[model samples]
Target: MKKFHRDASTLVLTLISVLLLTVSALICLKALGPHGEPMPSVTDWISAVGQAVGALLTGGALIYAARTYSKQRQDRHEELEQKRQEQAGKIIVRVKHGLPDDRTSVSLTNPTNLPIFKMNLYTIDDDGQVIEGQPLSEEVVVGDYPGHAYTQRYRVHSAYAVFTDSGGVAWIRTSKGTLFE
Candidate 1:
């Protein structure tokens, strides 16, 4: 689709160039008429109308090119933002050894430099079932710098854990590895 738009814009630019050249040639011919005599009034008027039409066509083509360029820039920006989000979503949590009742807490370190706000935690049972956890007494705010970790002690037991950030991006971790969604 991008290639198609580029090709179409190129074609329009070429047509505009041709139209301009034609109008210029007509004006030159009128200025250097045969035997120094200008063409009839009717022919001069027709040429003037043609020049006006050519100018309008060139203006339209330029507007189209500007719009196409703007759209392409916007699309590129959106694509970059999506990729940044995917990278930002890679928050990892390491659960310390011990059972949920052992006073051990799950620790999350934000490797990213951007702070994470309003983060939430959930759990997965041995049966691969998700159990929604209760909200923290205070909102979870994780700083972006490395070595910045947040740990929460669980009141209940679960085999696996899931962490979600303010952006609604979630990551699941177990003994196996981390899974992102």
Candidate 2:
């Protein structure tokens, strides 16, 4: 739809340009002489027309360049925004060691417009044993809101998280790397 509108506008501009050029040429011919009495030279008429249209051509080129630059900037901005949203939606797991107790946190951020549902997290031991973990709540819908988090207080060790979204797609994440759905 937008492309159609842009093409239509370009066609209209081309037609207007042609009309303006024709009118200017006719005016130049009339100025030379109506009955061909003491008519100006052909070179003189051509020079006059070129001088008249020079400023209009310059202005049109400038306008086209400005529009192209604006469009490129807008496209770049939209691409960056998409990347930021993807980065924001990833599952982040962190472990904080304190004097009294070490706490591990599992969080899934939803930067998209759709709300996420039924997210769960799990803990992994040094022996690669999966232990039952907990979430801030069961079946929480998270979106632009603060969302939900699961935290456990234990000695800081190797751990990861697992969850399934409303789409029934499972996701796994660890502190080192390899976090995806």
Candidate 3:
């Protein structure tokens, strides 16, 4: 001990010994960390952080792409629907005329008159039950008319008719079906 204290290398040697003791204590404490210490492993912690960042970026990109695609598809669908409606006659209103002569009834044709859905007319009156009528002049007219296909696409929601030289127009036609039912 006297040689150590008096030696020229005394300070250097003491410092080396102290460093060695500190390193050994650190090793023991680290080795004991797994026994309920919850000390995270370096490799596992690094990988978990990387995966979370990757997942967040990927999810955000997917959501953006889905919304963009949906909006594009909706715009295209609306354009096509409008074009189709232009070629078809859109019904706005219909009025029926009660003729004194049952056979002499005439319909004032509206360019926007929608083609009928079913063959039945909805109203009845005192003079006679308003008979079921179709817009087509005749079965032959339906087959030969260039506009027959255009006529079939739309449906009328409601109408009123009066007996006269001419019948009234159709109202509120839509290619879209009633959503309520």
Candidate 4:
């Protein structure tokens, strides 16, 4: 839809420029007589108008090119951001129940090829209290499974994992599997 709008506007601008050029050409022709005689001061005015039209066309072309370059750059940036988000989403947080000692286990799985740093995993109870919390200073590599991080036997309502991805973007993942930066 945006591309359609841009093309429409560009077409309109081109049409307007063509109309202006045609009008100027007709005016210059009218300034000349049937015997090919020039009118006083009319030739100079026509030359100035021609120069102005050329400048207008050049400026328009430059503006169009700049806009195209800017749009392409923006598209590339968006594509890179989407790829980063997919990589971050690969970090999964799961809460396992029914341990041998009746304690809930909070497991973090990083399946991506890159590692995550400054990891903090927290298990929250029904009353929004933190049941167990584990903070890892070192980076968690790919396929590094930190299983049974929560040692408490409390009933966990949800779990949260906060860490920085390989791209240096911080993300928060919940037990419900929602991820965001």
Least accurate 10 contiguous residues by lDDT in model 3? 140-149
Q: lDDT of each model, Cα atoms only?
A: 0.53, 0.54, 0.37, 0.72
Question: Highest TM-score among the candidates is held by which one?
Answer: 4
Candidate 3 lDDT over 91-137, as tens digits, reads 22233233243222222233433333322223222333433443333
Query: Whose TM-score is higher: candidate 1's or candidate 4's?
Result: 4
Give stretches of model 3 more than 4 Å off: 1-38, 41-43, 89-181
How many steric clashes does model 3 contain?
Answer: 16
Candidate no. 2 TM-score:
0.38
Model 4, span 113-171: residue lDDT tens: 78888787777787888764444334565665565544454767778888888889999
Give lDDT tens digits, candidate 1, residues 51-101.
Answer: 667766776676677567767866897897686566445566444545444
Top lDDT hit: 4
Model 4 residue 122 CA deviation (Å) reads: 1.1
Candidate 2 weakest lDDT stretch, 10 residues:
144-153
Give lDDT tens digits, candidate 2, residues 76-177.
Answer: 878875654454346455543342333444344554554445555554554566544433344754543232232443333554545554455566656565
Clashing pairs in 2: none
Error of model 2, residue 147, in angstroms: 11
Candidate 4 differs from the real structure by a C-alpha RMSD in angstroms, to one decimal, of 7.2
Q: Which is the better candidate, 1 or 4, if ranked by lDDT?
A: 4
